[model samples]
Target: MNTFHLGLIINPLAGLGGTAALKGSDGVAQEALALGAEPRAAERTRIALECLRPVAERVTFLTFPGPMGADLLAQLGFAHQVLGSLENGATCADDTRQAMRLLQEIGCALILFAGGDGTARDICAAAREGQPVLGIPAGVKIHSGVYAISPRAAGELTRRLVEGGLVRLASGEVRDLDEAALRQGKVSARWYGELTVPEEGGFMQHVKQAGMESEELVLVDLADWLRDSWEEGVRYVFGPGSTLHGLAANLSLHTTLLGVDVIENGQVIAHDVTERELFNLVDGYPARLLVTAIGGQGHIIGRGNQQISPRVLRAIGLEHLRVVASKRKLGTLEGRPLLVDSGDPLLDDTFPDAVRVWAGYREELLYPVGWGS
Candidate 1:
């Protein structure tokens, strides 16, 4: 039988800083750990690899030893070949670049990595131009366009490739931010490079559009109206993004620029909440989720705001979910539908065919929502 060699790389410390409220995990793995952040890259990788289990007999993973990749593959009982040995310490960018070099040497059909934009940079630096690589979003910094909508989306796209389905390849941008600047409320994002990634409308996210929108007045109007219309006793979950941030600012509530927050009756109930914290806090409360689509990508769920997890969505009830985006931001999508890849196929299916996007004051558009396979 012909074997499909898939290269796997996992930065075990990729998202350690997210829940710790440290912003990005690029340089502060130790600090994040000290702050009670648990390693979750391997778990995210497991979620992606689970989709390939049906094709295990045909797919063989080429990966690095230990936590980087091999451990998860072994746990899933997938056939894999460990490329190189890791040292007696935590893996770094060098390890990731080295793994990419090894994978390129073996000519992997497609390379699947679990991490944020930093990991994408490492892969871009080492990968040959046009080489296919896909990212499973597992980081605090995911402005890069390289990652799939969610972990399951990455696995589903990979499974399609292994199953000989028609898959087109596209270049995905590798972008990262200055974590220090990000911590100080300054947005400093830079484009390092690009990687060849598989393209599926709802599967791959577009590079996060930065800077202020032309519709600043519209945003101000929407924020003013939403704040005025805030329902009492209802917990409002404000998701991450500049649009939502602007709305929260209008309410005069201090919130995280890139983290999830919960507000109730104009008071900050929870700030910089993690997935678990969100689940616990909203479980029994009458809550509403407010999220905006990525400017160019049109992903309303499952890009950087994994904190608004599938379980959280269920607890909040889909009907209570609200999407807010400016008309200009929605225009960037160029007629593409807003996407929902909540990592749970069942829950994703339950989303309304079209969602009501609050564009401006009393201006709502019924936008179609796409659930990519």
Candidate 2:
């Protein structure tokens, strides 16, 4: 029984921009921190490690020093070796690159890094074709296909890899968006490179697509149904996306293109609300959450609208949840089920076997929802 050597890297600042609604943590990490952004990468990485705990004895971890990777592994009591050195405080791109070089040199079987697009770019720069890698999605803008859908999924994939299961390696895209342009309410994304990703049936994520133009008629039909079905006194919480934005347009209400909004009595009470703000607004009211899936990925909760959150979802109850997707968008999934990675395993399990996706006017499709690995 050969022990699998898994390289681990943690970009401690990956998801700091999410709660702050900074769109992404690249370039504006300092600003996000000043706005009281808390470190989330370590906790997300811990979640992945927790899922891998059952197979702990079959693996030996190789990681960087301190907050980069070693601290979390130490806390989790995993057998690990800290391979490189870094400053005591903030870790940079250079640190990640150096760590990757060292990990590859030491012959790690597979490298598991935790971060967003920037971290993915750094790892790609330092790694070669034959070296397999996977991402633990702990960042704000995760448009890359190299990541597992969630941390728990990452753990499960890693477990399969280490146990010599029939997981196959495939070329996965690395995409980074312009955070500056995103903050200005503009989307600019580009391809950085590709990496070798371990693929299982429904475990890996698909790269995000910018826009889908063919869904216009579908949007109008869905909007018409929503307009007729509007209820009084029940707060309607709209998650981020153009589909929901279309519904807002049809209802003659204003909504942010990429931010959460709350509507009550057919009026926008809260525009561009945060997770905490959303929770506050829906505290005692009967609330219904209206969300749309990612155009190509079919992720309803975890990808962009972390503001909905697992706690918020539990409060809204599964019955109060409404999902909308265009027929064109659903077609992109190719029989794969809709995904939910709310960062809370228990809450994820509470979702019903299948939810109804409003595809058109008075049209609904029962789609299976996938969680866990």
- Of the candidates shown, which would achieve the greatest lDDT relative to the real structure? 1
Model 1 residue runs over 4 Å out of place are: 201-373
Candidate 1 lDDT tens digits, 153-271: 99998886665443455667899998999899999889898887876633113323444445678778887788778899989999999888888777688889899999988899899
Q: Residue 195 of candidate 2: its Cα lDDT?
A: 87
lDDT of 2 by residue, 1-373 (tens): 3355689999998998999898988877898899999999999999999988887986789998888889999999999998867766678989989999998777665789999988998988998764678899999988999999999999997875554333455679999988888889889999988987777732223222534435677777777788888889999999999989987887789899999999988899999999999988887789999999886677898988999987788788777887887656766776566788899988876675445566677765445567633
User: CA shift at 112, candidate 2, in angstroms?
Assistant: 0.3
The number of clashing residue pairs in model 1 is: 0
Shift of residue 304 alpha carbon in model 2, Å: 54
**Cα lDDT for residue 151, candidate 2:** 95
- How do the predictions measure up, each by TM-score? 0.54, 0.54
Candidate 2 global CA lDDT score: 0.81
**Local distance difference test, each candidate:** 0.82, 0.81
